[model samples]
Target: MTTKVLICLYENEVCPRFDLTREVLIAVIDRDAAVLKEKEVVLPQASLEMLCQMILTEGIQVVICGGIEEEYYQYLKWKNVKVLDSVIGDCKLVLQRLVQGRLKSGDILVE
Candidate 1:
Protein backbone atom coordinates (compact mmCIF):
# COMPACT_ATOMS: atom_id res chain seq x y z
CA MET A 1 0.00 0.00 0.00
CA THR A 2 1.18 3.49 -0.77
CA THR A 3 2.04 5.64 2.21
CA LYS A 4 3.17 9.11 3.13
CA VAL A 5 6.14 9.60 5.44
CA LEU A 6 7.44 12.64 7.27
CA ILE A 7 10.90 13.08 8.66
CA CYS A 8 11.95 15.88 10.95
CA LEU A 9 15.18 17.44 9.70
CA TYR A 10 17.93 19.75 10.91
CA GLU A 11 20.92 20.66 8.76
CA ASN A 12 20.29 17.64 6.50
CA GLU A 13 20.24 15.29 9.47
CA VAL A 14 17.43 13.91 11.58
CA CYS A 15 16.52 16.62 14.04
CA PRO A 16 17.62 15.64 17.52
CA ARG A 17 14.41 16.85 19.05
CA PHE A 18 11.03 16.69 17.36
CA ASP A 19 9.51 19.53 19.38
CA LEU A 20 12.38 21.81 18.39
CA THR A 21 12.43 20.99 14.70
CA ARG A 22 11.63 23.72 12.24
CA GLU A 23 12.11 21.78 9.04
CA VAL A 24 10.71 18.51 7.74
CA LEU A 25 10.95 16.22 4.77
CA ILE A 26 7.80 14.62 3.43
CA ALA A 27 7.72 11.73 1.00
CA VAL A 28 5.10 9.74 -0.86
CA ILE A 29 5.94 6.13 -1.60
CA ASP A 30 4.22 3.40 -3.51
CA ARG A 31 3.33 -0.14 -2.51
CA ASP A 32 6.71 -1.36 -3.67
CA ALA A 33 8.35 1.26 -1.48
CA ALA A 34 9.60 3.47 -4.29
CA VAL A 35 9.59 7.14 -3.53
CA LEU A 36 7.04 8.91 -5.69
CA LYS A 37 7.44 12.46 -4.41
CA GLU A 38 9.48 14.22 -1.77
CA LYS A 39 9.77 17.75 -0.48
CA GLU A 40 11.20 19.72 2.39
CA VAL A 41 8.97 21.98 4.40
CA VAL A 42 10.27 24.81 6.53
CA LEU A 43 8.17 26.14 9.33
CA PRO A 44 8.39 29.69 10.62
CA GLN A 45 8.56 28.37 14.15
CA ALA A 46 8.62 25.11 16.04
CA SER A 47 5.33 24.07 17.52
CA LEU A 48 4.27 20.54 18.37
CA GLU A 49 0.67 21.23 17.57
CA MET A 50 1.59 22.69 14.21
CA LEU A 51 3.67 19.67 13.42
CA CYS A 52 0.83 17.31 14.27
CA GLN A 53 -1.58 19.35 12.24
CA MET A 54 0.70 19.32 9.26
CA ILE A 55 1.14 15.58 9.47
CA LEU A 56 -2.58 14.97 9.59
CA THR A 57 -3.37 17.51 6.89
CA GLU A 58 -0.72 16.10 4.63
CA GLY A 59 -2.02 12.51 5.07
CA ILE A 60 1.25 11.38 6.57
CA GLN A 61 1.09 7.70 7.54
CA VAL A 62 4.54 7.44 9.06
CA VAL A 63 6.72 9.81 11.05
CA ILE A 64 10.47 9.52 11.56
CA CYS A 65 11.86 11.69 14.29
CA GLY A 66 14.22 11.86 17.24
CA GLY A 67 13.50 12.51 20.88
CA ILE A 68 9.78 12.96 20.60
CA GLU A 69 7.93 13.40 23.88
CA GLU A 70 5.66 10.67 25.21
CA GLU A 71 2.55 12.80 25.00
CA TYR A 72 3.09 13.82 21.41
CA TYR A 73 4.03 10.29 20.45
CA GLN A 74 0.86 8.95 21.99
CA TYR A 75 -1.13 11.66 20.28
CA LEU A 76 0.18 10.65 16.89
CA LYS A 77 -0.50 7.02 17.63
CA TRP A 78 -4.02 7.89 18.64
CA LYS A 79 -4.43 9.56 15.29
CA ASN A 80 -3.28 6.30 13.61
CA VAL A 81 0.10 7.62 12.52
CA LYS A 82 3.04 5.27 12.78
CA VAL A 83 5.94 6.94 14.54
CA LEU A 84 9.54 5.78 14.43
CA ASP A 85 11.21 7.78 17.14
CA SER A 86 14.76 8.18 18.38
CA VAL A 87 16.28 7.73 14.96
CA ILE A 88 19.63 9.45 14.33
CA GLY A 89 21.16 9.58 10.86
CA ASP A 90 21.52 11.57 7.70
CA CYS A 91 18.08 12.31 6.36
CA LYS A 92 18.74 10.67 3.02
CA LEU A 93 20.14 7.52 4.53
CA VAL A 94 17.21 7.29 6.84
CA LEU A 95 14.87 7.54 3.91
CA GLN A 96 16.68 4.76 2.14
CA ARG A 97 16.35 2.46 5.10
CA LEU A 98 12.71 3.35 5.48
CA VAL A 99 12.04 2.55 1.85
CA GLN A 100 13.72 -0.79 2.35
CA GLY A 101 11.45 -1.49 5.30
CA ARG A 102 14.52 -1.93 7.46
CA LEU A 103 14.34 1.16 9.57
CA LYS A 104 13.02 0.84 13.12
CA SER A 105 12.37 3.04 16.10
CA GLY A 106 15.40 3.92 18.20
CA ASP A 107 17.74 3.06 15.33
CA ILE A 108 21.01 5.02 15.23
CA LEU A 109 22.71 5.05 11.85
CA VAL A 110 25.34 7.69 12.37
CA GLU A 111 28.83 6.77 11.24
Candidate 2:
Protein backbone atom coordinates (compact mmCIF):
# COMPACT_ATOMS: atom_id res chain seq x y z
CA MET A 1 0.00 0.00 0.00
CA THR A 2 1.23 3.44 -0.82
CA THR A 3 1.27 6.12 1.85
CA LYS A 4 1.32 9.87 1.52
CA VAL A 5 3.25 11.82 4.13
CA LEU A 6 3.29 15.55 4.82
CA ILE A 7 6.03 17.33 6.67
CA CYS A 8 5.62 20.86 7.94
CA LEU A 9 8.72 22.88 7.02
CA TYR A 10 10.47 26.12 7.81
CA GLU A 11 13.64 27.04 5.94
CA ASN A 12 14.62 23.42 5.22
CA GLU A 13 13.99 22.33 8.77
CA VAL A 14 10.90 21.03 10.48
CA CYS A 15 8.74 23.92 11.51
CA PRO A 16 8.84 24.51 15.21
CA ARG A 17 5.06 24.70 15.42
CA PHE A 18 2.49 23.09 13.19
CA ASP A 19 -0.12 25.82 13.39
CA LEU A 20 2.41 28.43 12.37
CA THR A 21 3.88 26.60 9.46
CA ARG A 22 3.51 28.09 6.02
CA GLU A 23 5.41 25.52 3.99
CA VAL A 24 5.15 21.75 3.79
CA LEU A 25 6.84 18.88 2.03
CA ILE A 26 4.63 16.12 0.68
CA ALA A 27 5.86 12.74 -0.41
CA VAL A 28 4.27 9.65 -1.91
CA ILE A 29 5.87 6.37 -0.89
CA ASP A 30 5.04 2.94 -2.19
CA ARG A 31 4.56 -0.22 -0.15
CA ASP A 32 8.23 -1.02 -0.49
CA ALA A 33 8.97 2.38 1.09
CA ALA A 34 10.35 3.97 -2.05
CA VAL A 35 9.50 7.60 -2.53
CA LEU A 36 7.77 8.00 -5.85
CA LYS A 37 7.08 11.72 -5.71
CA GLU A 38 7.78 14.72 -3.53
CA LYS A 39 7.00 18.42 -3.55
CA GLU A 40 6.85 21.49 -1.43
CA VAL A 41 3.63 23.35 -0.75
CA VAL A 42 3.61 26.93 0.33
CA LEU A 43 0.43 28.04 1.98
CA PRO A 44 -0.95 31.55 1.78
CA GLN A 45 -1.08 31.68 5.53
CA ALA A 46 -0.52 29.62 8.59
CA SER A 47 -3.77 28.11 9.76
CA LEU A 48 -4.39 24.79 11.37
CA GLU A 49 -7.79 24.54 9.70
CA MET A 50 -6.25 24.97 6.29
CA LEU A 51 -3.63 22.42 7.09
CA CYS A 52 -6.25 19.91 8.17
CA GLN A 53 -8.23 20.57 5.03
CA MET A 54 -5.16 20.04 2.88
CA ILE A 55 -4.38 16.76 4.60
CA LEU A 56 -7.90 15.46 4.11
CA THR A 57 -8.16 16.68 0.54
CA GLU A 58 -4.76 15.41 -0.44
CA GLY A 59 -5.33 12.02 1.23
CA ILE A 60 -2.33 12.35 3.44
CA GLN A 61 -1.92 9.31 5.64
CA VAL A 62 0.80 10.67 7.88
CA VAL A 63 1.83 14.10 9.13
CA ILE A 64 5.26 14.85 10.55
CA CYS A 65 5.49 18.12 12.38
CA GLY A 66 6.96 19.84 15.40
CA GLY A 67 5.27 21.21 18.50
CA ILE A 68 1.64 20.73 17.62
CA GLU A 69 -1.06 21.73 20.07
CA GLU A 70 -2.95 18.97 21.82
CA GLU A 71 -6.22 19.92 20.17
CA TYR A 72 -4.84 19.80 16.64
CA TYR A 73 -2.92 16.64 17.45
CA GLN A 74 -6.08 14.89 18.56
CA TYR A 75 -7.99 16.27 15.65
CA LEU A 76 -5.50 14.87 13.14
CA LYS A 77 -5.50 11.53 14.91
CA TRP A 78 -9.29 11.48 14.86
CA LYS A 79 -9.13 12.13 11.14
CA ASN A 80 -6.94 9.01 10.79
CA VAL A 81 -3.80 10.93 9.89
CA LYS A 82 -0.86 9.68 11.92
CA VAL A 83 0.65 12.74 13.59
CA LEU A 84 4.34 12.66 14.40
CA ASP A 85 4.91 15.74 16.48
CA SER A 86 7.87 17.42 18.07
CA VAL A 87 10.31 16.17 15.48
CA ILE A 88 13.40 18.37 15.13
CA GLY A 89 15.72 17.80 12.19
CA ASP A 90 16.43 18.51 8.60
CA CYS A 91 13.45 17.69 6.44
CA LYS A 92 15.46 15.18 4.42
CA LEU A 93 16.57 13.28 7.49
CA VAL A 94 13.06 13.20 8.84
CA LEU A 95 11.76 11.83 5.55
CA GLN A 96 14.48 9.21 5.48
CA ARG A 97 13.48 7.90 8.89
CA LEU A 98 9.85 8.02 7.96
CA VAL A 99 10.44 5.88 4.88
CA GLN A 100 12.43 3.44 7.00
CA GLY A 101 9.58 3.26 9.51
CA ARG A 102 11.90 4.54 12.22
CA LEU A 103 10.58 8.02 12.77
CA LYS A 104 8.61 8.57 15.98
CA SER A 105 6.76 11.34 17.67
CA GLY A 106 8.89 13.67 19.72
CA ASP A 107 12.02 12.51 17.99
CA ILE A 108 14.81 15.08 17.97
CA LEU A 109 17.27 14.34 15.22
CA VAL A 110 19.34 17.46 15.56
CA GLU A 111 22.36 17.10 17.82
Candidate 3:
Protein backbone atom coordinates (compact mmCIF):
# COMPACT_ATOMS: atom_id res chain seq x y z
CA MET A 1 0.00 0.00 0.00
CA THR A 2 1.03 3.61 -0.45
CA THR A 3 0.40 6.72 1.61
CA LYS A 4 0.40 10.28 0.42
CA VAL A 5 2.12 12.77 2.71
CA LEU A 6 1.98 16.48 2.11
CA ILE A 7 4.46 18.87 3.65
CA CYS A 8 3.68 22.56 3.79
CA LEU A 9 6.85 24.27 2.55
CA TYR A 10 8.71 27.57 2.64
CA GLU A 11 11.81 27.33 0.50
CA ASN A 12 13.48 24.12 1.68
CA GLU A 13 12.06 24.04 5.16
CA VAL A 14 8.69 23.48 6.71
CA CYS A 15 6.67 26.66 6.56
CA PRO A 16 6.35 28.36 9.94
CA ARG A 17 2.64 28.97 9.51
CA PHE A 18 0.10 26.82 7.71
CA ASP A 19 -2.21 29.52 6.45
CA LEU A 20 0.71 31.46 5.00
CA THR A 21 2.12 28.57 3.04
CA ARG A 22 2.27 28.99 -0.69
CA GLU A 23 4.09 25.80 -1.60
CA VAL A 24 3.80 22.17 -0.66
CA LEU A 25 5.75 18.96 -1.16
CA ILE A 26 3.84 15.76 -1.71
CA ALA A 27 5.40 12.33 -1.46
CA VAL A 28 4.02 8.85 -2.07
CA ILE A 29 5.56 6.31 0.26
CA ASP A 30 5.08 2.61 0.01
CA ARG A 31 4.89 -0.08 2.65
CA ASP A 32 8.64 -0.71 2.39
CA ALA A 33 9.34 2.91 3.29
CA ALA A 34 10.50 3.81 -0.21
CA VAL A 35 9.26 7.01 -1.69
CA LEU A 36 7.45 6.07 -4.88
CA LYS A 37 7.03 9.60 -6.06
CA GLU A 38 7.53 13.22 -5.01
CA LYS A 39 6.12 16.45 -6.29
CA GLU A 40 6.15 20.10 -5.35
CA VAL A 41 2.94 22.02 -5.71
CA VAL A 42 2.88 25.80 -5.84
CA LEU A 43 -0.46 27.31 -5.04
CA PRO A 44 -1.84 30.29 -6.93
CA GLN A 45 -1.67 32.25 -3.68
CA ALA A 46 -1.60 31.76 0.06
CA SER A 47 -5.11 31.09 1.19
CA LEU A 48 -6.34 28.69 3.84
CA GLU A 49 -9.39 27.78 1.87
CA MET A 50 -7.39 27.04 -1.26
CA LEU A 51 -4.90 24.96 0.66
CA CYS A 52 -7.62 22.91 2.27
CA GLN A 53 -9.21 22.31 -1.08
CA MET A 54 -5.92 21.20 -2.56
CA ILE A 55 -5.28 18.83 0.32
CA LEU A 56 -8.57 17.08 -0.16
CA THR A 57 -8.47 17.11 -3.92
CA GLU A 58 -4.99 15.62 -4.00
CA GLY A 59 -6.00 12.73 -1.73
CA ILE A 60 -3.45 13.64 0.90
CA GLN A 61 -3.49 11.16 3.77
CA VAL A 62 -0.93 12.85 6.00
CA VAL A 63 -0.04 16.50 6.46
CA ILE A 64 3.25 17.79 7.86
CA CYS A 65 3.13 21.42 8.69
CA GLY A 66 3.81 24.11 11.26
CA GLY A 67 1.46 26.20 13.43
CA ILE A 68 -2.05 25.40 12.19
CA GLU A 69 -5.26 27.09 13.25
CA GLU A 70 -7.53 25.03 15.46
CA GLU A 71 -10.44 25.17 13.10
CA TYR A 72 -8.43 24.07 10.10
CA TYR A 73 -6.70 21.39 12.14
CA GLN A 74 -9.98 20.02 13.38
CA TYR A 75 -11.44 20.15 9.93
CA LEU A 76 -8.61 18.12 8.47
CA LYS A 77 -8.90 15.62 11.27
CA TRP A 78 -12.59 15.36 10.68
CA LYS A 79 -11.84 14.59 7.07
CA ASN A 80 -9.47 11.79 8.15
CA VAL A 81 -6.16 13.41 7.30
CA LYS A 82 -3.37 12.85 9.79
CA VAL A 83 -1.96 16.27 10.60
CA LEU A 84 1.53 16.51 11.99
CA ASP A 85 1.59 20.17 12.91
CA SER A 86 4.13 22.40 14.64
CA VAL A 87 7.01 20.78 12.79
CA ILE A 88 10.08 22.92 12.05
CA GLY A 89 13.01 21.60 10.04
CA ASP A 90 14.66 20.98 6.72
CA CYS A 91 12.13 19.34 4.42
CA LYS A 92 14.54 16.53 3.63
CA LEU A 93 14.99 15.68 7.29
CA VAL A 94 11.28 15.75 7.86
CA LEU A 95 10.68 13.41 4.95
CA GLN A 96 13.37 11.04 6.14
CA ARG A 97 11.87 10.85 9.59
CA LEU A 98 8.45 10.32 8.12
CA VAL A 99 9.57 7.41 5.95
CA GLN A 100 11.14 5.88 9.03
CA GLY A 101 7.83 6.11 10.84
CA ARG A 102 9.20 8.47 13.47
CA LEU A 103 7.95 11.89 12.45
CA LYS A 104 5.56 13.49 14.92
CA SER A 105 3.68 16.70 15.55
CA GLY A 106 5.56 19.43 17.42
CA ASP A 107 8.89 18.07 16.17
CA ILE A 108 11.68 20.67 16.10
CA LEU A 109 14.50 19.37 13.92
CA VAL A 110 16.32 22.66 13.48
CA GLU A 111 18.99 23.77 15.90
Candidate 4:
Protein backbone atom coordinates (compact mmCIF):
# COMPACT_ATOMS: atom_id res chain seq x y z
CA MET A 1 0.00 0.00 0.00
CA THR A 2 1.08 3.59 -0.61
CA THR A 3 0.48 6.70 1.46
CA LYS A 4 -2.09 8.75 -0.44
CA VAL A 5 -2.17 12.54 -1.07
CA LEU A 6 -4.35 15.01 -2.96
CA ILE A 7 -3.13 18.16 -4.70
CA CYS A 8 -4.99 20.93 -6.49
CA LEU A 9 -3.90 22.09 -9.94
CA TYR A 10 -5.18 25.24 -11.57
CA GLU A 11 -4.51 26.97 -14.89
CA ASN A 12 -4.05 30.26 -13.06
CA GLU A 13 -3.93 31.57 -9.51
CA VAL A 14 -7.52 31.08 -8.47
CA CYS A 15 -9.72 28.02 -8.91
CA PRO A 16 -11.27 28.72 -12.32
CA ARG A 17 -14.15 26.30 -12.23
CA PHE A 18 -15.72 23.76 -9.94
CA ASP A 19 -16.38 21.10 -12.56
CA LEU A 20 -12.69 21.35 -13.33
CA THR A 21 -12.13 19.71 -9.94
CA ARG A 22 -9.77 17.33 -11.61
CA GLU A 23 -8.27 14.21 -10.18
CA VAL A 24 -7.06 13.68 -6.67
CA LEU A 25 -3.48 13.75 -8.03
CA ILE A 26 -1.18 12.16 -5.48
CA ALA A 27 2.30 10.70 -5.30
CA VAL A 28 2.25 7.04 -4.34
CA ILE A 29 5.59 5.69 -3.15
CA ASP A 30 6.33 2.04 -2.57
CA ARG A 31 8.44 0.50 0.19
CA ASP A 32 11.68 0.83 -1.82
CA ALA A 33 11.97 4.61 -1.22
CA ALA A 34 11.70 5.28 -4.96
CA VAL A 35 9.44 7.70 -6.77
CA LEU A 36 6.65 6.44 -8.98
CA LYS A 37 4.26 7.97 -11.46
CA GLU A 38 1.35 10.10 -10.23
CA LYS A 39 -2.37 9.45 -10.54
CA GLU A 40 -5.40 11.69 -11.15
CA VAL A 41 -9.07 11.02 -10.60
CA VAL A 42 -12.06 13.16 -11.46
CA LEU A 43 -14.17 14.15 -8.45
CA PRO A 44 -17.60 15.63 -8.32
CA GLN A 45 -18.71 18.64 -6.25
CA ALA A 46 -22.34 17.67 -5.94
CA SER A 47 -22.65 20.07 -3.03
CA LEU A 48 -21.05 20.92 0.27
CA GLU A 49 -22.71 17.96 2.01
CA MET A 50 -21.64 15.57 -0.70
CA LEU A 51 -18.02 16.73 -0.58
CA CYS A 52 -17.69 15.57 3.02
CA GLN A 53 -19.05 12.15 2.23
CA MET A 54 -16.85 11.88 -0.83
CA ILE A 55 -13.73 12.40 1.22
CA LEU A 56 -14.55 10.08 4.13
CA THR A 57 -16.09 7.49 1.84
CA GLU A 58 -13.25 7.71 -0.69
CA GLY A 59 -10.45 7.29 1.86
CA ILE A 60 -8.78 10.58 0.94
CA GLN A 61 -5.89 11.27 3.26
CA VAL A 62 -4.84 14.76 2.28
CA VAL A 63 -6.14 17.69 0.26
CA ILE A 64 -4.03 20.36 -1.50
CA CYS A 65 -5.49 23.31 -3.28
CA GLY A 66 -4.36 26.81 -4.21
CA GLY A 67 -6.97 28.03 -1.77
CA ILE A 68 -9.96 26.33 -0.27
CA GLU A 69 -12.96 27.94 1.26
CA GLU A 70 -12.35 28.51 4.96
CA GLU A 71 -15.55 26.69 5.81
CA TYR A 72 -14.57 23.55 3.96
CA TYR A 73 -11.11 23.69 5.42
CA GLN A 74 -12.56 23.43 8.91
CA TYR A 75 -14.68 20.48 7.92
CA LEU A 76 -11.69 18.63 6.48
CA LYS A 77 -9.60 19.30 9.56
CA TRP A 78 -12.34 17.89 11.69
CA LYS A 79 -12.17 14.70 9.70
CA ASN A 80 -8.45 14.39 10.54
CA VAL A 81 -7.17 14.90 7.00
CA LYS A 82 -4.11 17.07 6.52
CA VAL A 83 -5.04 20.38 4.95
CA LEU A 84 -2.39 22.56 3.31
CA ASP A 85 -2.92 26.24 2.72
CA SER A 86 -1.39 28.67 0.18
CA VAL A 87 0.35 26.00 -1.87
CA ILE A 88 1.31 27.23 -5.35
CA GLY A 89 3.45 25.73 -8.11
CA ASP A 90 3.94 22.48 -9.95
CA CYS A 91 1.33 20.34 -8.20
CA LYS A 92 3.42 17.23 -8.76
CA LEU A 93 6.58 18.52 -7.09
CA VAL A 94 4.58 19.86 -4.18
CA LEU A 95 3.03 16.47 -3.65
CA GLN A 96 6.42 14.81 -4.01
CA ARG A 97 8.05 16.91 -1.30
CA LEU A 98 5.02 16.44 0.89
CA VAL A 99 5.08 12.66 0.47
CA GLN A 100 8.80 12.67 1.19
CA GLY A 101 8.04 14.74 4.29
CA ARG A 102 10.22 17.58 3.02
CA LEU A 103 7.57 20.12 2.21
CA LYS A 104 6.11 22.13 5.05
CA SER A 105 2.57 23.25 4.72
CA GLY A 106 1.98 27.06 4.61
CA ASP A 107 5.50 27.72 3.24
CA ILE A 108 5.20 30.09 0.32
CA LEU A 109 6.13 28.60 -3.01
CA VAL A 110 8.95 30.42 -4.73
CA GLU A 111 10.23 30.09 -8.27
Q: Could you tally the backbone clashes for each prediction? A: 0, 0, 0, 1
Task: Give the TM-scores of the predictions, in the order they appear.
Answer: 0.97, 0.96, 0.97, 0.68
How high is the CA lDDT of each candidate model? 0.95, 0.94, 0.96, 0.59
**Residue-wise lDDT of candidate 2 within 4-86, one digit each (tens)?**
99999999999999999999999998878799999999999999889999999999999999998899889889999999999
The residue-by-residue lDDT of candidate 4 on 1-20, one tens digit each, is 56556665564231322224
User: What C-alpha RMSD separates each model from the true structure?
Assistant: 0.8, 0.9, 0.8, 3.7
Q: Give the C-alpha lDDT of model 4.
A: 0.59
Candidates, ranked, TM-score:
3, 1, 2, 4
The TM-score obtained by model 1 is 0.97
The TM-score of predicted model 2 comes to 0.96
Tens digits of lDDT, candidate 3, 37-57? 999999999999999999999
Q: Candidate 3, TM-score vs. the true structure?
A: 0.97
**Where does candidate 3 stray beyond 4 Å?**
none
RMSD of 3: 0.8
Q: Which residue pairs show backbone clashes in model 2?
A: none
1 or 2, greater by TM-score: 1
Give the distance in Å from residue 108's predicted Cα in candidate 2 to where it truly belongs.
1.1
Q: Pick the candidate with the highest TM-score.
A: 3
lDDT of 1 by residue, 34-62 (tens): 99999999999999889999999998999
